[model samples]
Target: MKPTDTQRLLRRMFDAAIAAAQPALCVPPLLPPAPKGRLVVIGAGKASAAMARAVEQHWPGPLSGLVVTRYGYAVPCERIEIVEAAHPVPDAAGEKAAARLLQTVQGLGADDLVLCLISGGGSALLPLPLPGLTLADLQALNQALLASGASITEMNCVRRHLSAIQGGRLAAACHPARVLNLLLSDVPGDDPIDIASGPTVPDPTTCADALAILRRYRIRVPPTALAWLESGDGESLKPGDLRLPLIDTHFIATPQRALEAAAAVARQAGLHAHILGDAIEGEARDVAKALAGIALQTVRRGQPFQSPCVLLSGGETTVTLKGQGRGGRNVEFLLALAVALRGEPGIHALAGDTDGVDGQEEIAGALIGPDTLDRAWALGLNPRERLDANDGHGFFEALGDAVITGPTLTNVNDFRAIVIDGPPTEAP
Candidate 1:
C-alpha cells in the first residue's frame, strides 16, 4: 500500500473512533426515564456541554440546569446553561459555575431529578476548592500533578479530596433528589470514581489516600491544605453516606467502545484488525518502545500476527515533563515510536486524542511513516534531540505530520493505529 493510502486509512479509523463516542449518538439511548417532577441537569468536562445538549434534544419534559466545559467546546443548548472554562487547569469561571451547580440542586425533594453529565477534564472544570483552600492552590496542585507522571486514578484521588463539588459532594447536595450520572469515560478502566473524579458517584478513597499520593509524587500543597487532609477535614463522601441521594451511574462512551469502532473501520477496508488492549497505561515514550517492538516483530517475522494487519489500542498515557518544549502524550508517543522504528519500511502509524486537543496545543496528535525520520534528517532535524527535549509537537509540526482536528466534542482518551503492510508478493 502507498503511504498516502496508509495515512488515509489511519485517519478514517480515528474519525470512526471519535464519531462512535459522540454524545448525540451515545447519550440519548442510555438516558434514564424522565423524572416525575423537576429534571435539573448539572455537569463538568470537555464533553459535558455536548452531553447536556443531547439531553435537551431527547427529553420529553422541560429541564433546566448548568454544565461547565472547556473553552471552545460548548455546543448550542437552550434550556441547560453551558459555561466555558479553562481545562487541565481551573479558573474563576469554573469556580463560579461549580458554586452555582451546587446551588442549582439544593432544596430538591425525592420527586426531582438531578441529571449529572460527567466526562474527562471535568476534574479540572469543576474546581470548587474546600472552604480553607483557594483557586490558586488548586491551580498549583493541578500543574504539579500533570508533571508528576502519576496515573489518572492517583491524580484524581487527590483532586476528589481537595474539591467541594467532586467526590460525591454534588450528589450529596441533591438531598432527596434522584441523581442519574451519565459519564463519558476517558480514563483507563472506565472506573466511575475516576471519571471527573466522581462528582456524582461515591468515592471509596479517603483523605489519607490522597495525602499518600501527594507524598509519593512529592507534590507540595499549602499548610492549610495539608492540615485539612491530615485532620480528615477535607474527606470526600464515602459510599453509604446518608447525605448522598439515590444515584444511578451509566457510561455512555468508553475507550474500549471507541477502539471497537475503529476496528470495524479497518475490517471494512479488508484489513485484519487486532485489538491489543483497551486500557494500556504507562509513560508515553515507554509505551512507544513497547509498541515499536511488537510492530517490528510483526513486520520482520509475522510471529504473533500476520502482515497486512492493523494493531489498535486505546488508553490514556502520561509524560514526565523534563524539557521546555511543547508536548502531548499522543505526539510524544508517535515521536518515540518513530525513533524506535528507525525508518523501518512497510510500517506506518498514527496516535491521537479523540478530543482533538493533545496537551495544551490545538493539534490532535501526529502521523508517522517509514520516511518520517528520513524527512526529518533531510531538514536537519535530530529526532533524538527532539524527543529528549519533549518537543514532539514542534518536531511533528515542522515535518507537516501533525494531525489537527479542532473540537471533536468528545473524549475517549488516546487512539493508536499501527499499520503494517506486507510485501507486494504476500499482500492480501
Candidate 2:
C-alpha cells in the first residue's frame, strides 16, 4: 500500500524503535560467562525464544534448555526448545511449558549455568499456578487486572505472589546452580522484578502488597489465590534468600534505549528530536491529551521545542475499560490525540507497541494527521463517541489507517512519535 509521508515517517520511527532492541544485536554482549558444568537455559516472554537463539549462537559449549514465549513468537534454536504459549492469559500450553521449564532447571550442580531470558509478557506466558489454584483462576485474575487500569507494577506484584514460577521461584528452583538472568525492560522505572514478574530475580514486593493492590483495583481474585496471599503462604522468594545469591541479572534492552534509537533516526532526517520521557505512565487518553498539547504548542507557539522536530516517548499506558469495543492502548491514544488536536495541520503522530501487537489485537496501532477526524466523521463515525466507547480499533480500521506488523518477536513496551513540521511553508 502507498503510504502518506506522515504514515511513512511514523512507521520509520516505530521500526527504528523495534530495531534497537533486537535480540541478536543486544544479547551477544550481555552473555554471561559459561559455567564449568552443563549449561541449562530457561526463559519466558515474547522475546525469550529469540534470545535463546542468540545464546545458542554465542556460547562455546553445548547447551540444553527450554523457554516459553507468546504464541506465534517462537524462533528456531539448535539445542534449546522454544515452547509457544498464550499471552496476557494463562493457558494449558503455558501451564505445561512452565512445568517443563522447571524440570529443565532442576538437578543443576553448583557449577552449572542456568540462563534465564526474560522480557515482557513472561508473567502470563509462564503460568504455573500456585497449589490449589487452577489455570482458570489465573486467567480470571489476569482479565480483571487488564480491565482495572492498574499499572504494570501493581499487576505484576499480584502475579508474582500468586504464581509458583514467578517472583523468583524459578530461580530458586535452580538452588545451587548459578543463574544468569538476561532481561529486557518493558515496565516503567525498569524494575527488574517487574519485568515478566521477575521469575529469576529476587522479589521485593510482599504478599500483603499484592492483596492491597488487588483491592485498590477492586479485582476479585480467585478465593484460593486470595486466601494464599492473605496468609503469606503464596509469598515469593525474599531479597536475601540463599537460593538467589548466585543469581546475576542484566537489563539488555530498555524503552529508554528504544526511544533514543528513534531519536537518532529523527536527527538524521534533519529534525530536532526531543525525548519527553522513556517512562511516562498514565491513562492512554490522559497521556494523549498531554502529547497533543505539546505538539500543538510546538506548532502554534514554538515552546518546549521548535518546529521541524519530533517528540519521542515510551511507556505502557493503561486502559480502563468502559466499553465493549476492541481497543488497543496505542490506538486509543492516537484517537484521543486526534480528537484533542481538532485536525491541526503540521502535526502528525503514531503510537505502537514494540512487540507489534497493541493490547490483545494483532494490529500494532494507528497513525493520525490533520485529516484523521475528518475522515472518521465522513465515515459516519463520531470521534468522541468512539473514544468513549474505547473503539479506536474500529475507528481506524474503517479509515484504513491501522498499522499491522504481525509479530515483532521482541517487546520493550510502547513506542510513540509526534512529528511537528512547524509553520506552513516548511511543513512536511
Candidate 3:
C-alpha cells in the first residue's frame, strides 16, 4: 500500500527522534575504561531503560544497577533492573524506586564508577519528597504545575527544591566516585540541570526562584517546602563545588539533533525544510498563532522558503488547562493553528510528542490539512468551542485524526511539521 504524504512525513519525524535517542548511537566506547571498584548504573526517565540496556551491551565488564522508566517503556536488561513508574505524575512505585536508587549510590568509593542515565520525565519518575513533605504534596504540586502551563525549567526548578534526590544532590550522594551522566534532553533548552530535574547535574536555579514559581502558579506547597524555600537552606550543588569535580555530564540526545534529523528526512522527500529554533517555549495557543502567521506568509507571499517546503520545529510547548477535556500541548497547538488557518488549501501539518503520548492521553497528537476545518464543520463540531474548552484531543479524536503510536519508549519532545505544497496556482 502506498503511504500518504502525511504518513511519510510523520514516519520520517519519528525515525529522526529514534535516531537521536538511540543509546548505542550516543554512548562513547572509551568512557574512562571500567573502574577498579564496582560499576553502578542508576537513572530515571522515559528513555533511561533503553539507555541502560545499551550501556550494559557495550560495557566490557559486568555491571549491576537500577533504572526507572515510564510504565510500558521498559526494555529487558540482563543485569540492570528496569523499574516501571508513572510519568508527568509521581506514584508510590516511582517513589520507592527513587529511594532505592539513592541508597544504591550512597557511600561509593573514589575507585568506583557511577553511570547515570538521565532523560525527560525523570523528575516525576524519581519522586523522593523532601524531609517532612508527603508524596501527596509532591503529587499536588505536580498537578498544579502541569495545569499552570509552566515551562519545563520552571517546573523542574520547583521540583528540585522539594525533592530529596534532585538538583545535584544525587551526584553529591555518590561522593568520591567518578560519575558520568548520559542524558537525553526533552527540555526546550537542553539544560542538563533541567532534564529530569537534574538528578545528578548541578542546579543553577535558586530556592527563591522555585518559590517564585510556586507563587506565580499559586501552587500550595507543604509548610516544610515553604520554609526551605524561604530559608534558602537547601541550595543545589553549584559549579566549582569540590564534590562536582569528578562528575562529567554528556548530552546524548537533544531537540536540536532531533530537528536536524527531521530536516534531513524532509530533504530526502524532495521538500525544502526549514528548522526554527529547537528551544521554543511559551503557551501552546500563542505559539501556534505565531507559527500560523508565518506559515500563511510563506504560503501566500512566498517569503520564507517558497512552496513545496516543510517548516519543522522541536521543543516542549505548554497549555494552561481550563477545560475538563483531554488535551496535550501538541494537539492544542495544532487545533489553534487550524483555527487560524481557516481552511487554507495546499497545507498540511502534524504535531505530536515523540514519546507517543500527549498530555496524559494515549494519542501522540493530531494532523491538520486544508480540509480540517471543513471536515469538522461537516461533523457538526465547533473547533473554537473545543479550543476554548481545552479539548484539542477530543476534537482531533472525533475526526479520527489523532495519531496513536503507543509509547515509542523515547522522548525528545514535541515534533511539529508544517507542510506547504505549491502555491494556490498549483491546485488540483
Candidate 4:
C-alpha cells in the first residue's frame, strides 16, 4: 500500500533527524587511540543520551560517566548513566544533573580522556548558574528570552554568560585531560560553541554581547547577572587557553545533512527538491510569510522551480510569544504560512521539530493543506485567534492535524516542507 502524504513527510523528517544524530555517520573510525587512563563520558541535550549509548556500543575501552536529557528522551545505557531533566525551561532535576556532570569531569589527569556528547537542548539541560545568580533568576530570564523572538544565537550568547558550564567552561574543568567532543548541531552555522551553548567548546562571544542581547529584548535580568556581565568575570575559554591544548571537537550531525536526506526522499517521491537553506533563522511567523512568498512565486512564475517540486528547509526557528496559549515555533510557522496562503490551492505543507517535540509541547508539529483555514472555519474555529494565542497545538489538535511522534531520541532542530501539486483545482 502506498503511504499517505502525511506519512511520507513524517518518515522523511524522522529519517532526516536520525541521520543527523547517528554516531557512525558522525564519528570517525580513525580517532586518535584512547588515552592510557580512565575514559569518562559526559554530556547534556535531547540527543546526548543516545549519543552516549552509541559511544558505549562502539568504544573498545572501558568507559563510565553520565549524561542528562529531556525527560523521556533517555535510552538504555549500561555503562553511562542517563538522567532526565526539563528543557526550554530548567528544573531542579536539571540543576542536580548538571552538578553531578561537573563533579564527574573534575580532577581528571592528562592521560585520561573525556568524551563529551553535546547536542541541542543542552543549554537548558545543563543550567548551572554562576555565583550570585539563582536558578529562579535563570528561569525567569529563560522565559523572557523564549517569548522575545530572539534568535538562538542571541539567546545562547546570553545563556553562556549566565552559565558555569557553558561556553567551554565544562571542557576547561577537565583541564589537562584529553577532551573529545562529539556534537549533533541544531544551531544555524553549526558553530560548535553555539550548539548546546558550547558546553565543551571555546566561546568567542563576550559579556558585552550578552548584555546587548538583553537590552535588545528589553529583558530585565537579575542585578547580579548584570554586574557579572559588567565585570567580564564570566569570560569563557578562549582559543589560546592552554587547557584546550589536547581538545578535539567534531560535528557528527547537522541540519545540512538532514536537509540532504529530505531532498533525497523528495527526489525518490518523484518531486524536484530545492533546499532553501539548512540554517534559516528569525521569527517563525515572519519566516513563514517570506517562505509563502517564495512558494507563491514558484507556482506563478515557475522561476525558482517548476511544479511537482518541494521546497525544503531545516533549522531552529524562534517564536516571540504575544499570547498566553501553548504553541511551538513549528506550529507558529505553519499557522503564519496558512494565513499568508489564504486558502490558495495545490499547496500542502508541514513544519515540525526533528526531536518529536516542538517548544515545550508534546506534539512534534503540524501539517496544513490549502484548506487548512477552511477546515478550521467549517469546525467553527478561528485560525487567527489561535495563532494570536500561540495555540498551535490546540488549533491543530482541533483539526486532527497535529503530528505527534514521542521522543525520537534525536535532535537536529526543525524540518519544514511545502509540496505544491501539479496545478490548482476546484475545491474538493
- List model 1 lDDT by residue over 1-428, tens digit each: 23498899999999999999999999989877877889999998999999999999998888899999999999999999999999888999999999999999989999998888998999999999998899999999999999889999999999999999999899999989999888999999999999999989999999999999999999999998999899999999989999888998889999999999999999998888999998999999999999999888888887578878999998989999999889799999999999999999999999999999999899999899999999999999999999988999999989999999999999999999999986433322
Candidate 3: residue 110 lDDT (0-100)? 90
Of 1 and 2, the candidate ahead on lDDT is 1
**What is candidate 4's CA lDDT for residue 146?**
88
Cα lDDT computed for each candidate against the true fold: 0.92, 0.89, 0.86, 0.85
Which candidate number maximizes lDDT? Answer: 1
TM-score of 4: 0.95
Clashing pairs in 4: none
lDDT of 3 by residue, 224-270 (tens): 88998899876777777777638887888788888888888888888
Write down the TM-score of every candidate.
Answer: 0.97, 0.97, 0.96, 0.95
lDDT of 2 by residue, 1-428 (tens): 36777678778889999999999999999887667898888899999999999999998888899989998999889899989999877799999999998888878789898888999999999888999999999898899999899999999999999999989899889989888889988998899999989988898889999989988888887778878998999999989988764988888999999999998888888899999998989999999999998888778877777889999999899999999899789999999999999999888888899998988999899888888888888889999999999999998999888989888878999989999985633332
Candidate 4 lDDT score relative to the true structure: 0.85
**Which rank order by lDDT, best down to worst?**
1, 2, 3, 4
Cα error, residue 376 of model 1, in Å, equals: 0.5
For model 4, state the Cα shift of residue 355 in Å: 0.8
Error of 4 at 196 (Å): 1.3
Indicate the TM-score of model 3.
0.96
Candidates in order: C-alpha RMSD to true structure:
1.9, 1.9, 2.2, 2.8
